[model samples]
Target chain A: MQTVKLPPLFTPPTPDSPVPSVPFATPLPDIHVTLFRNIRNAVDVRNLVIKGDPRVPECVLINAATIVDVFQIQMACTKALLHQQQGIMRTRSLYSEILFNLSPTNNISDAIRQFGISDTTTAVAVVMVGMQAPPEEVRLRLLTLIEGEPIPLSHLPEFTDLPLINRIYKTGNVAADRGQTLALVVGAMALKGHLS
Target chain B: METHEAILIKQGAEARVYKMPFGEGRCAIVKERFKKAYRHPVLDEKLTARRVIQEARCLQRLRRAGVDTPTVYMVDTPNSLIYMEYVDGSSVRDYINSRAPMNDDDERLLAQSIGKSLAVMHDLDIVHGDLTTSNMIVREGSQSLVLIDFGLSMVSSMVEDKAVDLYVLERAMISTHPDTEGMFQCILDTYGKSSKGGKAVRKKLEEVRRRGRKRTAFG
Candidate 1:
């Protein structure tokens, strides 16, 4: 007589525990950036440019911590600057888009006006989005575009527009710590399109 | 997809959840909807994309309403994945089951919190399609319960829908927890008093229960 073997029962694992890692998709393109401080003529740079005009020299300042979180999404390569090569987001520079990225709303004009580079922007952080260019090459290009002193990212908090960011993202009551605020910001940005 | 690693957490029939590396030091939960073999490719993609968006949006709206839920970290529609905050907590089901002979007041407080959260969501016109203790997590340290898994959730305000939501929770409670009659009753009592339309909802819930009983008896 032939005997049939019973299949093993599927025991449900504890939902909160970590499971094994599966194969992932392609790796992110390498990114390298340099920060510049004491940028001269920021107001002049802001004023010389016309709205919706891409021909003017680009000098946009962005929040360092915020931008990093924005780029970590699986489909963010299309939206954030980290995935694009230099000169790709020229029409709406990466600097401006990064600012727009911070705002939960979709009004590009308001975002640009509030979060984009301003005359008061004395410090700037520049990162290679998805480009293959060397750091020195990119740094020189940025230096020539807007005159500034290269500074480390640590000094970014002193220069970041926290009040404006708070106003834009409506995260003032989220938490006192900057890290928690950043987490809230990341969650906000990720849920941008899904918000009812 | 790059340097960072995402450890698989659970693989339900609908999606595979993973604990992914998020902002420095913080970890995020990534829910990826794997392609279904039964459905057509295009249909599956569309359905998955829609569900991901719906789930993320619901969490966002709930948070805005001050309802306790996970914070969405990122939504990759093209990839059919939702990256959100990994809340550290134990499911109320396990919490109650393992820690039995529990404090009556604490249990009642948790049940009240669940009732209140549900009331708030209903007021906001959001429905938690699957309402069970398993889906509600009691956060570590804070001892607050958070609602998770919004894949089947939707925006609806119909009285029947609301009644059904509560009815589902009641049934789940009966089957999962021992001696939960008091807990479930407390939920209904608190829920009825929590909102302006709570009385109406309780009345409707009775009708739903009667209909459910009829279906079960006839079938």
Candidate 2:
């Protein structure tokens, strides 16, 4: 009698936790402007160019830490952060890095396998933003986000404890509106100049 | 290996082409790899893999979208091999040239067909980086046009970039084929009729054409 052998099931490897790399920490140089006629749809992947810094040029997935690093310099994620049927933009000042997003399609390991974006296009730059909060709360929200588990709004301590902190969720493809992205950049820079 | 000796097919810059046996002499092309010293080993592997994946993806997308390209039977990235359907047809260039003293109706029909094909590609926002007549294969009497070579294809949604791609093709045709102006005009006319952003593209193309004319005049 012949015995049957089953094929091995495909298992994706997990992503490496972001280790602090001594990146070439220079300031952003260019202030390229993008004009927009469609103000309503300006946030659509319309006007933004996500350019990664020297350490990670030509990749779209901006690591959360990297986002934090850039955010410290006041750069923000031009592309909308996506969760299942949701688009989020954080105004936090504590912890920053790429979201390491869970896929909308239920292939749990896909995020870890690809580093973040399915197509980590190098032609675009991904910026990170960060801020300060209790380590546990930040970690939990993020873990839930990446794990793609349904951790409700109340589970996030900031959202529950502080009414000032808002967690906004909208269902759509989060894309950059070139005009708005440029406007934000210009506004931030002008504000920074005023502060200086 | 012995199939090439039996069938005598020519090799390419990167891969050797041969008519070979696939499950007891059911016809297939065997593509053998050639080495590149310039690129690093890891990079080379990644590039080959990406190209194979991209071609397969582009073909699938085109096939799904009803655009014509050969079916990819096999892809061995490690070996840099891609076995595709060998189109039993003449190139659009040959077919165009062979028809001596081509009339306006013939030119317009060919151009319209080309435009429609391009419109389909542009609608999906796939930039065919190398759009040339040589890349397009056709039947003997120009019954149909099948676009080949996804070597430089990339997914993009920029209207400006798409315009630039068409503009590049326009320049290429102008340089290669004699009096391609009327043909291109017809192609553009057809393209304008089909594409959603035709008005914007037409405006962009005019600006591009102006720049081209300036370059020519300066040169």
Candidate 3:
């Protein structure tokens, strides 16, 4: 009789700060994040969002604005960032399409207008969703267009557009609990395409 | 069985359930609907895709209606897999069977909870086509009844549909626990008291039973 040995599968989460497993095909991609605290050229950015320059495909267009709430922006950019870093364009156009995903409605124009980058976006976080290159190189690339100081991801809550998110998700009357609100939004987002 | 990382938990004709890691610390139940060899490849793919999407939508709708259900993490259509929160609890079927229903107050509570949840779901016009006790899980700590599996569910506003939903449950109860009609009565009673439409549904249920008896008697 032949005996088959199964590999030990489950790993218990230790007390040592557990790193969230990256949900990607590629191994480890250096994620670069920059927080732009001040934007002197708000109108310019908004103009770039409204109109397009075909020469720069990845640059500003209708969905190219970075004005969405931190959470929504994070969700939209995460996949694109990962794919971009991996040099795989699964969802070819992430900028405009991702903005569309953020909104609960079917109106692509409205979604882009509401969730896309806007003129009022004073603080913006540029997160490298993929770790293809060095962090410094990714950071430098983001700074080419964005004008602001680089800050840590922990400072994100401060940049959260609460009222806008509440208005968009229609959870304005939700109780003043950040956890509950985020859960509701995440649930809504997860059920976006299929809502019968 | 090709057991690489995922542990097979359950297998049915339509799909296979596996226990897999969801995130760093948590586990998830992945229901994978494999391609059927008997059917045409295209037809099989379309059927599985539609069912997976439909089930996920029903789960979301149920949660929004304030009914307890597993949270859906992601729906991978191409793979025909639904990654959902792993609910750790005993099925209501086993729970009721092990404990003496006639003497236990908790059994009554469980019945009432199920009734109330059914009322809410019916009110939302969500008909749980399969309402067996096996589809409900009694949470280990909270004792809250979390309904699972909405693959066979649909939306309907008709009183007959709601009544039929209850009737399905009634039939299941009779089959699963032939000696516990009292518990089933409690379920019906609680369900009837929970909503205004419940009375009408019960009336329709009686009509359904009468028609069922007449067909059996004549045929």
Task: Please give the DockQ score of every candidate, comma-separated.
Answer: 0.22, 0.01, 0.14
lDDT of 2 by residue, B158-207 (tens): 77767877888788787778887888888888888988877687788777
What's the true lDDT of residue A103 in model 3?
62
Q: What CA RMSD would you report for each candidate? A: 9.8, 19.9, 9.1
For every model in order, what is the number of clashing pairs? 1, 24, 5
lDDT of 2 at B111: 90
lDDT of 3 by residue, A68-167 (tens): 3344444444434433544653433656655565666666777767765667767655443345555555456556555656566556677666677777
Best by TM-score: 1
TM-score of each: 0.76, 0.47, 0.73
Alpha-carbon runs more than 4 Å astray in model 3: A1-92, A140-150, A155-163, A170-184, B1-4, B97-105, B140-143, B177-180, B207-219
Docking class of 1: incorrect
Clashing pairs in 3: A29-A131, A30-A131, A65-A117, A66-A117, A67-A117
Poorest 10 consecutive residues by lDDT, candidate 3 chain A: A1-10
